[model samples]
Target chain A: MNQNYSTVAQRSSSVLATNKVLRNTYLLLSLTLLFSGLTAGLSMFLNMPPMTYLISVISGMVIAMFVLPRFANSTAGIGIVFLITGLLGFGLGPMLTMYASLPNGGNIITLSLGGTGVIFMGLSAYALATRKDFSFLGGFLMVGFLLVLIAALANIFLQIPAMSLAISSVVILIMSGFILYDTSRIIHGGETNYVLATIGLYMTIFNIFISLLQILGIMGNDD
Target chain B: MDWMQIASALALGMFLIILFPAALQMMKNSPKAAPSDWKAVIVPMIIIVLFIMLLIKLV
Candidate 1:
């Protein structure tokens, strides 16, 4: 009886821990999204030059990869999350403006935003409800990500619109896989830190949104 | 070339440098997958593709 009781207690505690992480991650993600949106709006209002985006985004990635992880365990991580996300959003400002300039730009943006929301919600719900281990995707997705990055970098010189569309489509698939992997990790206790979890999800959503925009823009021929 | 093109190439190149080695290491360490795993990934992807196609058609 004691052995059985101990097992039950351990499982219960694991479940509780998972719940806490999942709850905190979603809460932080929502707040950060709102924060980023505001910064993007400010950037758009200022009409920052196009180059502002590339520089800010590169800086954000560098910080997120190198600096944020160090502070991820402390309260300072929250502030850093905001800083990184704000920089990314601000970078998006000029891109959004360019899209909005297209004849059907407004519609394209709205549709992309909606599509991203739907995909994220759908995938998250599936992973949470099923509680499957998607850790297996890590290798495959990482390899695909590298391959796509190589393609994208090469295409910078090529500058082919069709290739851009292909890259965007592949990116969407990769991001979708990440959503499932990240959500599953939260449920299975693979990820314990809500801060890191929040960053992972936020970046996935950010990638999905941007990829959708590129895909939609190309499909709409807003060149 | 325009400044924007130069900036993009530089940024993308840096991103590749930062992400490449890490990704390769992760891939090296990741576990081998079962068929069910691939199915899990593929089904959802197909749905996503169809959903995207629908969205494109709507556009």
Candidate 2:
């Protein structure tokens, strides 16, 4: 009887801890997303120049890889996450502007945004509902990410439209995988740091949105 | 190559090289737990494919 009581208590406490992490991660993720959007909107309003690829990549790497990890256990981590997301968002302004310039650009943007939202919600809901341990995908996702990164970099020099489309397609798949993997990691207690988890999920969403936009843009041009 | 091309190449090369080892390290450290349900993986992938098809049809 005593053993049974302790087991119940332990399980409930574990569940409560998991719930707290989920709650905090989602809360912080929402705020950082909004902050990113605001910065993007501000950049658009100001007609900021398109961020050069090199600068965006370098700055993104510096913040995400170098800075965020060091501060991830501290309160300052949240601020650094904001800085990374905001910079990426500002970089998005010019891309959005370019899309808005197209003939059916507004429609394309709307469809891509809607599609991204649907995919993110669907995948995340599935992970949370099932409470699955998707950690096995970590290895596969990392490889996929590396492949996509290399292809994207190569396409920059190749300037091949078809290759760009292919890269975007692969990226969408990889990002979706990341969403499942990251969310499941959080639920299963594999990841306890909400800040790091939030950033991972945020990056996944960002990549998905960008890839969808690229695909929609290409298809719009085709029609 | 021009300066811009050179810089892009160098940055991209460095990023990729750094990423490879980092990813390996991450995988090494990740928990070695079997997935609870394969359907969780399959369903999301199917959804992604269908969604992409829908987007392609939209434009």
**Prediction 1 TM-score vs. true:** 0.96
Q: What is the interface RMSD of each candidate, in Å?
A: 1.2, 2.4
For candidate 1, write residues A1-223 as lDDT tens digits: 9999999999999999999999999999999999889998999999999888888888888889999999999999999999999999999999999999999889888989899999999999989887889988887888898889889988888999889899999999999999999999899998999989998999999999999998888888734
DockQ of each: 0.74, 0.53
Question: How good is chain A of candidate 2, measured by TM-score?
Answer: 0.95
- How far is A5's C-alpha from truth in model 2 (Å)? 2.0
Query: For model 2, how does the per-residue alpha-carbon lDDT over A164-217 read when each residue is reduced to its tens digit?
Result: 889998888888988988988888888899999999989888888888899889
Model 1, residue A187: distance off in Å is 1.2
The pairs that clash in candidate 1 are none
Off by over 4 Å in 1: none
TM-score of 2: 0.92
The residue pairs found clashing in candidate 2 are none
RMSD of 2: 2.2
